[model samples]
Target: MRRVSEANGLRIWVDGDLRDEATRVDAVARFQTLLGILRAWRSEAGELRDEQRAGLGEGPVCDEAGNQFLSIGPVRTYTTFGGEIEWFAECTRRGVGMSQHLRNALWLNGRLNRTAADFYMIHEYAGVEFGGSLGIRDKLKLSTNSQGRLTRAANNLSPLEGGRHAKQSGEAGMTLDEQRTYVADLLRRWINLHSAA
Candidate 1:
């Protein structure tokens, strides 16, 4: 628990986890008192700004296009007392449907960056179920070989020659150019969804 004296002569009390009954009741009473004080104070709505409401160090984010894109902060990973990994965030927003889209994008990016298992899973699903296109099943198979090994050899040797290798390997059913076009379309759609007004 923590308490501080505000410049306006208001006592600010921040209580930690209130386990005991007494602490809980006292915290509730303190919150009620604070609420009453705030309600009693009258202020002009115009005096408040969006940045102020968003608190300190919060504002518009920039994307690759250098546009002011609204984004939820990156997801935070923490280890709990029980030795389990978890994520936590307290998100507040002003724009319509902002939180939903921002959160979805942030969560997806975080999962991809941290684990990448979801990425492989989704890629497999795309190859098997949707044929790698948005909704076109082009008969792309993503399962392992008969020996339960990845069909495509892990060719991290030459990124410049990746397309040729993929074509020669015959693992990726679509040509490199076709794959690039498909990915470009997908990225365009994703950017549109995230940057929609």
Candidate 2:
């Protein structure tokens, strides 16, 4: 399939080898399905943006020291209503740049995908020590056991909690909501530490 056009918030893709009636019908059906899914996703995203705007006023969130950390605004699109937010505390640490992993983890957290958020934190952001001997996980004071639990949860160790494997007896781990809170707090602390550097 190839994209034919995108106009007025709608994208059109055309598939090759549609000379046959059955193939043409199938292609049209598939296109309709894709359009439906896009519409639903867009609607959900818009609702989330509305909720965020209502909860957080139309202004940048500032830290206690009056440093801006996050700012939310509309996405400039010609035909769709969307939102985007920039989140980053001013990094004052010498030779320490703001990591994209941290930014992506924070963004995924806002999307309510705790599993992906935790994966980014554990696999990407936590592995690198920002100019210190301790990695981000260590800086966050996450115990070895806690780190293992988070890794297990993010890597699909328990089927009961969105994991791939069947749930074992007494395989307790932090719930997705709990992980969300924990990761968010850690990211906040990280931002604060960098802000004060």
Candidate 3:
């Protein structure tokens, strides 16, 4: 658990190029807003894993007595625990409706690096589940970009790819909205696709 927690945390590094006071504030505000909006969004739809939440406890948070903060800081800079970075943005793998994909582009690329040339965001899902069993499922893996087409070929490499559409339809058929929602979520989660200055 400690290893996963350490490996999964976001560690943002700045190269001293953070200039312009307003840009810095706007950047900070954007991250702040994204966290707020996403939190509301998650509340409406339900978080992906309540079990994980239970074990991990709330994040970016500390109690005066080391308990719970309820709504913790999403974008924390320096930390006695984690390193300097923008956020501990919680991921939502389920129930994220459509239109979020476009929003993700706007937030991650548009918001995450307001004062710098670029930044890195690290996200880890509990891993994808196809069947009740874990061994032969088509779990999501990271990609170089957010474009779904580019990654589809790679995903097809899995033996499970043979009946994915049918299996997906059988298990949980996404309405067009659900389809777009999960697709967008998957895109945001897997896309290593970063932005430049």
Q: Which prediction has the highest TM-score against the true structure? A: 2
Residue 56 Cα positional deviation in candidate 1, in Å, after optimal superposition = 38
Q: Estimate each model's TM-score.
A: 0.20, 0.41, 0.20
Q: Could you tell me which residue pairs clash in candidate 2? A: none
Candidate no. 3 TM-score: 0.20
Where does model 1 exceed 4 Å of error? 1-102, 112-116, 121-133, 136-188, 194-197
RMSD score of candidate 3 (Å) = 16.5
Please tell me which model should have the higher lDDT, number 1 or number 2. 2
lDDT, model 2, position 31: 48
Model 3 clash pairs are none
lDDT of the candidates, in the order given:
0.31, 0.46, 0.31
After best superposition, candidate 2 residue 158: deviation in angstroms?
A: 4.2
The deviation in Å at residue 52 for candidate 3 is: 14
Clashing pairs in 1: none
TM-score-best of 1 and 2 = 2
In terms of TM-score, how similar is model 1 to the real structure?
0.20
For residues 1-197, write the lDDT of model 2, one tens digit per residue.
23235542334455567687877876655544333222222322322344445434444577899887666565533342333111221231211255555444444444432343334353346456453224654565656666666655665546545454464444446666556445555555655565556
| Every model: Cα RMSD to truth | 19.5, 15.8, 16.5
